[model samples]
Target: MLDATLKAQLKAYLVHVRQPVELVASLDDDAKSNDTWELLNEIAELHPDVSAVRADDDQRRPSFLIRRVGTEVGVRFAGIPLGHEFTSLVLALLQVGGHPPKLSEEVLTAIRELPGDYSFETYFSLTCQNCPDLVQALNTMSVINPRIRHISIEGGLFREEIEARQIMSVPAVYLNGEPFAQGRMDVEQILAKLDTGAEARAAEKIAAKEPFDVLVVGGGPAGAAAAIYAARKGIHTGVVTERFGGQVLDTMAIENFISVQHTEGPKLVAQLEAHVAEYGVDVMALQRAQALVPSRSPGGLHELYLASGATLKARTVILSTGARWRSLGVPGEDAYRNKGVTYCPHCDGPLFKGKRVAVIGGGNSGVEAAIDLAGIVAHVTLLEFGDQLRADAVLQRKLRSLPNVTVLLNAQTTEVEGDGNKVTGLTYKDRTTGVVHSMGLEGVFVQIGLIPNTDWLRDTVALSTCGEIEVDQHGRTSVAGIFAAGDATTTPFKQIVIAMGEGSKASLAAFDHLIRLPAAGEAVAA
Candidate 1:
């Protein structure tokens, strides 16, 4: 559909940049739109350094074609890049970038084999900046492959649709006519869900008959500790976890947890699980607690429903669900995570020994990670997107005294670059001067704050404005039968020791409450 002269020029431009280019057009014959094919041809001729091509006939009629010039990649969009359709460009670019992105092989294969056309609609708000990364990730997937499409609608723009879909929060994604996923999602996860949807539906139908007693949400230190204590008390305790070990599992080596001078996160989790298993704690992995409901009776009996349709009942509840690391949501950050990217310096810092690394964030965690890494890594670059470090003066002093650490204020991460399988470097832009520069690094650790896992409790329990469940000193939630602990609660310190301490206290409190209930019930019956 494109003019040969323009296509030739675009091909030349791509060659100049040494990247690939792709032109994607819609397949809907009845759909009215501009002549994207002709426009691409003209652009191709105008920018000969970039290559232009069309999707193969067998690949599907509505799909696009991708061609690599040298190293640079370009996309000629046949449709608006806004909304759900924008994902195409991101996918194409990722393909041109020579990385498969962060998708599982099985899911990727499934997506490749999918035929016809399907679209995903995600509803979100501008206030939810977190939603954009998810949108971009989906878009990237759609671009590389034609079977998938993504659309993001601003919640405000589609208020009626959002209400009808029951979208009470930001970042809710829907596939076809059914709700697919919500909140922050990576490409791999999205693909996996798509591939397993049928199986998941079948499993859900089967799990509806079973229920649990004392459902301990989360598998982090606090949740694990709670489950162990509850099981030891002879309560039928079960743990439903989206992922085992919560945030702590992502940690490399924890030196601060008392009694254990240095221990790997996974190892620690395994030990915890072993102890928990001794008491026969029912461990359910890869499941999330979607909601909690209190009994209609006066006495506090609660029910917990999981996303998988499994229901749980409890005389008393303990919420040890932890928090997650907040991301900068900038370009390349997600793509490079764990490749040349990391969230836990204590886990991955030593891996960068004798190599350059960057630590993004200026808070206490960032300062601490920088200080810790400076001693092991060859050179450490600390970037603060703010005007100054928010860490205490003592930590700031310690960071400043470190010879290997270089702190840059008002700096922002622009992109992460990698060499095929791993991270090679990153680019940072100066907020004040608007100048961008790239630095080679073996790794980049992101230490930006955390978000409590308390969104689902909004209606069931009282939560702080920041989404932390409010609890008494003894970790008792406002609800008489419900208790909370660790990072999920409004605790000041988020350390492992602190979380464990809270778990112990909450368990003791729950035991005391349980003890009182039976005696009072006997007296009432008499």
Candidate 2:
């Protein structure tokens, strides 16, 4: 069944249409034999304009295309509408129905006058929900203009294509057959790229530039630390980041970071930036590193290309891209995000102080959140989907000692209960008994795990099976000149203190490499 919220949004698209909307469910052979066919027939009969067409017969195939006419929207399920082909369906619908929200005159004019056709093909896995918004934003632009086309290929189904393209991560976008951008991009950036045509030319020019003494790939805590240290050593260093703060900006507060008893994530990031800036480190914000090209030089100088077509050469690179929160894929979880659903206990726990809350997961993060919340909240229900808590023995004992913490083992969160604005409770199923239960709570803290932001680096550096960048003790990657730190790297802990320490270490190593390099004018003496 279609979600009520999605259905309502779809209805909003039909305001200008005079003809009745038709929702056609295209069924396969299996669906025809099962009760799915009956359900489709029921829906078709209820709506006079709607039809359920079975693709079982050749004659019915024409009806599939016929129903698309005057239809403002179409939805696909089960079948793989991926790769270069998915763009066709979306374009057809947009052409037939027209844009519902409509674009501003300036945006529309800019899109129409876009000089050339630039197709961005992004390969993504279903696990990353964040990929969709990026793809959708691109598609929305594509809908408004004929020059730009966006394609999203599912990595799972199109394994061969993804492998051929050397895709290492979800939400990797390629522009005009070349790797153009990665990660999430805002609408304005997309428009600027489409309008300027400078990024494409810059990529070619950057390939010919000299490498830098040190290149920091992210501007987060780890990267900023590395940049400051490297710059202080008088090494020609540059920091390129999609955003200045990286994941630290997403955080609410930092209580565990040493020296600073308590600080917000953004505030901490600002301090790091200030420190780096004081050292005269070259910082590039709102820019993403497109690729890392290794130099033939023995001393480890490498070329770092940016999405905007700019390039920086460096003797050593420090990647402190950091990690993203792992989400619970259960229903209604997204609907209550920021309202009553939160990922960071340090960020949102205080809000639920003196109120009942549920912490989900069996790992160390889950146990830690529960133990911490026990001190502040009225009661904490620790729901572990595993047989037992996977935290360390000492932490498990501490959790058990807490009077207000209740541990529920082998419990899986099936759905998040919400009251439109905030979370009200949660529904879960017992793995052992097959019994389902619901509990009321003021908030839900998800502590499942963290996914390293190394997807974009797969083509440039080595990554572990767990998606972490593989690095040596000194924060050097398998590939020379490229270093990694923080949670994104193959470090033991995901703590801020550890990340900062690793950043410092990587910076020192980078500085050492820079000092050994030939001086600017003396290099040609050889």
Candidate 3:
């Protein structure tokens, strides 16, 4: 289902396979197993150096093994690779055969020093853009160290295991049968968890006399830009974030970032991080910001409390916490998410080309999604919970202009119906008549709304009715010395380019705010 351009890229990538790889499918008479077998066969046909084989034993029927021609890489894919995860399967093929390991001496040393044998079972879905990265990282680690056995389990194919583990999200990794991490994890992050010597050291509780000139919260695109700009001014800059790449890490194809024709989320995030690291910014990753409280002293230093019981004091703070899509709480919505139900049409819509799909919600986003999908998919079903669409008249008119688009008003999506492997249909009810209906489709896109990450701000700053932080034109919040940007603020049209610009603006504004303050220790000298 790849486009011409993507197919060309894949072919070029496949040409570098040094040794032949074998896909041994151990499949039963199930839909997921059959799908996996078919996809493997297709992949084998695509690459000259790859071939598929069937196993006679029932013990390993549903599972597939990918190993180099002579060497034993011990990589296992538990299900079919589809959606965004297809990239991971391709990468695994490249890395397994003749491609040198991409690791630093320090990381290699840590991997070799790992004490005992551990099996990493990572739960993932085909549509999850973030899962592939973690799976690839873990698999690479397994290749590096023989003691580590890693398997990428397709969550949709293993529902019983999912129920046993209570895996609600993709990329849920477990090391030695215990939970390791929940989201995308870079090599450094994973090694930190594995190597005891690399674990974070405890710091003694002592109130700091010195303060940072600027502190950027949230390590998303906005925070990365803010930190870069702030550090370039030669000021003491520090940034604390739960994850280095916020929502962007979960994104897949990003074709609209300006100048870049094609780039995945992790690739762009790596570049953003590299740019920020070029400066003198102290980035504290995997640190959650608990509360933002102003210092009791007269100098107006703001203290940011972290979940680890540490406080970060700064002269100015920039909020770029970002936002997440509002989810449908109905049954199978979470289970089938990233399987056949997706959130980003721009990212995952192309994967379902020539297949029927539905977009939930009646707002501008839903109509726009329907309009976008109608061109690619065989059919587009737009279901709105409201009596009428809340989209602009122009967008509504354009949506109606599409030949394959069908609009359903006052439709309440009750459940996302799906087979054990992928989405098959959706069940909804008519709000006016209370009549329930079902429609067969391959994908469901939830376009309701985005929930900002400003709830943790509490009553400290001015907030909108929907909990979005209120900020002025210069990215300055109602409270001086504190600024907000990106989806966390009242910024219209939440896009990466806009967030980067806003972050730059906020940094310059913070610098302006700092220049007006008394010189460091000048008041004390007085």
Candidate 4:
């Protein structure tokens, strides 16, 4: 099933495999084992350095052992790696065979201090963009310490185990049979789970923060950009976020960020965090900003409360809390999320290549997604709830031009029909005919609208009717010392380039506001 272009790319990447890697497939009586064996044999055919070896049912049931030719890190995949997760399988082999482990000293120390033997059973889907990150991080830990082990299980291939665990999402990590995390995670997050010391150190750092010059609320593209810009002004800036990457971590491929032709969401987020680390900004991660209390007096410090009961004071604040994808709220949609139902077309579209897929929504995003998926998938079915599509004329025209694309108007998606394993079809009601129909497809993409993360700031700042924070041209909100940017604000566009520009503007405006501040002594008395 590998295309020539993709095969070429795999060959190029395989050349860097310094040591021989073995794929020892332990087969069972299950039918899925055949599928797994087929995929592995195909992989072996493409790369001279990769060899597939089959084992009888007595050895183990449907597990692929991946290790260096001579050494064993005990790396095993319990499921077939398809879709976006194929990259994870490739990286796992390269990481195990190519180079020495390059984990930081702090992470290494935390691994060495593990209380006991820990194993991570990470359940994932081949189409899930976020699953590989957790799997790779956990795999690295296993390579460093023999006590730690991880098994990557593809949710589709191993349906029985996933159903037993009641898993409905990707990156569902279980530490020693106990649930650890459900979604995208970082190395520090995994470390914190392994030991309480990591969490304690983070809490201590957050509690020790005092008043600062600038405070950026979110840690997405806009917030990270704002923090870097503010710190460059030689001010003691602080950033409080639930996570360093914010919504960007949930995203997949980002093809349009300027200069860089192609990049994924996690890669871009890593770069953002790395760039922010170059400055002196106090980054308080894993803390959510719960409340905003304006300064009592002009030029005084504003008190920002976190969900952890910790309050941080800042002279100025920038709100860049990003937005989230709106769900269809249909039956089976939630149950099959990350199973065969995905929200990002750019990130997971490649996984559905040559497979029939459907895009739900008639807006610009839906049409755009349909157009994008048409090139990759065998067929694209676009469903619109309204009598007509809400997308722009130009986009609608472009969508109609694609031969493989089919648009259905006045179609209300009622339920996503899926087996216990993956999506089987889409069921929708035709408003015009009052008839419900099911279309067979392997994947479904939901592209309705973006819900801004501005509910928390409604009482503190001016918000649009749609719940986006209202900001002027200078990114200034109704509050004097507060500014907003990016998707959370009233910005017309929600692209990464636009968000970065907005962040730069907001930081510069915050700097300007600080320049007009009175002396420290006079500010307290005001």
Candidate 5:
């Protein structure tokens, strides 16, 4: 169960319990059930306000329900909720024990005001970094509204259910016994899906916002840094993004962040968000920018349109809309997405444990994914369309040393093979021989490089051949009163640290531009 240090930590956390909480188990006599009991027993013994009892009502063995003493505010775990889900379990206990959920007033009110029953079942893997947030959101909602119920099921522990439901990805969610969602999500995203008018309401709210001095159009490291720096300069700052973290949320290990020895993407994003919040930066999350309209006159407001038809105005705009994982456009790739084809190896690799899989591409990401998957899966076949690996020498050396990994250079993925359900294998072509081949496997991880999210700006901004926003050393774009940074720009490197530095530089440059401009509605030159 829990070690000494873990038990001590659990005890300290249990002190926040204000009401009697029960850990009702619906377990069998299996080894996993015994382990669950040990965990539950250790937790129950820590505080007087907590207790464990048997209730063999659920069909899922080794399951347990966390409920308040006198109310139906409860959540369930269908398996051992350790690893990434450990935080979800702790938060569930605190919330069910009468502690308020750590969400905004608007989100809390929305969850409590939901109209109908919502039995959310989130299928998760222990190693997935993206599953915890989604699971925790549902769990918190269940506690906030008794009509909502969330059951977090570990995909690794329940092989039958994973197969029966054809779940090939972690954090796969089901609402009221039907497919609901997949991938990383927060409370706001959940609400947007459940409430039909949530989008309209959010659009209206965003449209009512006043113009800002510096309005950043992303929420990755670059956008966060730009927003913080602008706000610190005593200028009105705002960040409008599709999501707060961007591709960073899908990332796992982040070892090269300078001062920080080691950290994960989600953890770093959380800290970045907190830092931005401290500066009182107006953050408009879950909003996608559709177009950018530059001001016709000096010091006039610049308009940024959203996909929801909501528009925001600002003095200067910083485009840091980062990049997304590039997918193999081969046939069946889209049809079997999350059904055996996945982009994130760190998040979905565990689902293919002990099974054969293929890693596409010859770049650093592809090689790294192959290396990481070698330790988890039975065998890994690395396919590269180039003649040689483009990863660093050190990475290539480590990848070559893996016994379970097979590297195939000059191989191009042609198509993904599936049985109208899950991915079965893939077809590839040999670059030199002009011969086609196929391999039977359970999963396919596409590690192709990222594509910058600058499609909407292609018509507005000066774009490079690859569609990256073209910018100078000072982060100034071709358009007046506009700047760009991060992966979306023509930056030499696509690292997080570089993006942040570029963002800060862009903010300073924007500030300089603002100070030299003429009064609003006055005639001036760029």
Candidate 6:
């Protein structure tokens, strides 16, 4: 049930309902069902267009359906969608009740014309920062087309089902009873995966696009800032990204972003997206850049190839592709990934409730993950390759204060041990004594560091030994008219504010490169 303050906020949001909405809940004698019944009643009273009733639409108990009055447009919930999913609930109510979803017209049409029947079952955690995107996206698709139905499940409340399915990650999605995806996914990304010819069609469309004056690849804070700055200069600007938010979407708490005291990653990404949209910057989402072919001449045109078989030409290019979580190449690590190995403690931590777990790394992320998981899991074993932890003194102190935490130094993770279905333990080597040991645990959280997303640009640009794009102080890369920024580049600290500043600097450097170039088909100025 919602409290007085939450009820007031829900009342304000309910005013957007232009059509009738109904809440049909399937219940039992359980406490969750009781809470669901009360929550549905409270929501129905918030607006005249909303109503609540009892029904067995689906056999799942303590679940509900938000259906439009006269149409099959709505979504189903396998458990009470609250906490991180509360936003999904609110957006579903509004979209199904005639409030339009914030999707491009092209995507909206694609969802409407989808041919096959799709029944999506998304398993999510209430604390996951990346789960809402898929939850809200599929819910909106169900509204767009009658053939598509989405049922989102809260993984914490359905432990038996999770174990049976061997699901170890948040936002694990299944399409028609088969594993579809296991990470953050937006509507466009989902459509690209579901529709077979969608990629080819998109490729052709992108190939036909006019060459941009300034083109940016990646959609993190750096890419967003670069696109905005370039667009402000009255030049043709475009940004292509596999997803708009990047790794920032996976981040849970962001309190040190300067100016603003506190904000979630999703909220910040939403604002960044909105800000980019305000400027007329052409946004090409759900596209991956496969290779970079720099133009031989300055300010001529740079060719960027996409994995979708599309090619984009730009006068200037800013590579802002961000980094991803570093993987432990140890055997069984890959096989056990999403089976018990994960990177995010905030999202998937609850799934390992009262279970023994290990955090590999000695840095801030590892210590923080250990501290956070110590509360939920039965015990925490932190294995560090170095002799001492590299985390801040404050964080190390806090991690040591936890009674359930155990720290091991000079320990090298050798292999992840699993039992075909799920992980059962780990193997590590003691560097000092050259002895091997094993620890029985249910989960492995890798927080060593980040690996830059720069494999696609390997031979095209000069890169550091660590694979980060080599860039000058002004953000100019080795290739003329080509610039780089953010985590993918040779930038230090790898913070959000630094990435934004670097992006602006790259845009300015790109603009300077552009103005000095001679007109098309003309020689250089004397």
- Per-residue alpha-carbon lDDT of candidate 3 for residues 1-526, written as tens digits (9 for 90 to 100): 4556666677788787887888878888888678778777766777888888988775434788787767667588887666667777778777765565677787787887889998888888766677777888887887777788888987766777876765545678888889888767877778877765453331123124257889999999999999999999999998888788888886666888999988878778989988998996888776778899865543579988877667788999999999888998999998887678877776556556678999998897789889888877899999998889999999999999999999999999999998876889999999999999999998999999889988789768899988889999999987779988887888899889899999999999999988887765767334
lDDT of 2 by residue, 1-526 (tens): 3345534543444343433434344444553334445544544454344455656543221123213345323332222332222333333344334434344586566666777776667655543433554666666666566456665555554556655764434456788889777655655567756556545554465556555678888888788888888888786778878777777765645798888898866567758878888988777666777777877766645777677767787767888988878889999888877557777665345456577999998798889889877887899999998897899999999999999989999999999998776788999999999999999997899999888877777887889999999888888888766788888988898888898889999999877666666776555334
Evaluate model 5: give its lDDT.
0.92
Look at candidate 1 and tell me the lDDT of residue 225.
82
For candidate 3, what is the lDDT? Answer: 0.81
How does residue 219 of candidate 4 score in lDDT?
92
Query: Which pairs, if any, clash in model 6?
Result: none
- Whole-model lDDT values for every prediction: 0.69, 0.68, 0.81, 0.83, 0.92, 0.92
Q: How many angstroms is residue 309 displaced in model 6 relative to the true structure, after the best TM-score fit?
A: 1.1
Better of 2 and 6 by TM-score: 6
lDDT (Cα) of model 4? 0.83
Clashes per prediction?
38, 5, 3, 0, 0, 0
lDDT of 6: 0.92
How would you encode candidate 1's per-residue C-alpha lDDT over 220-335 as one tens digit per residue? 88888888777778866777778667776656558988978898665687688778879888776667788989766434568888876766677778888899888778777777
Better model by TM-score: candidate 3 vs candidate 4: 4
Candidate 6 lDDT over 452-515, as tens digits, reads 9999888889999999999999999989999999999988999999999999999999999899
RMSD values for the candidates in order, in angstroms, are 16.8, 15.9, 6.4, 5.4, 1.4, 1.4
**Superior candidate under lDDT, 1 versus 4:** 4
The positional error of residue 452 in candidate 4, measured at the CA in angstroms, is: 0.6
| Local distance difference test, candidate 2 | 0.68
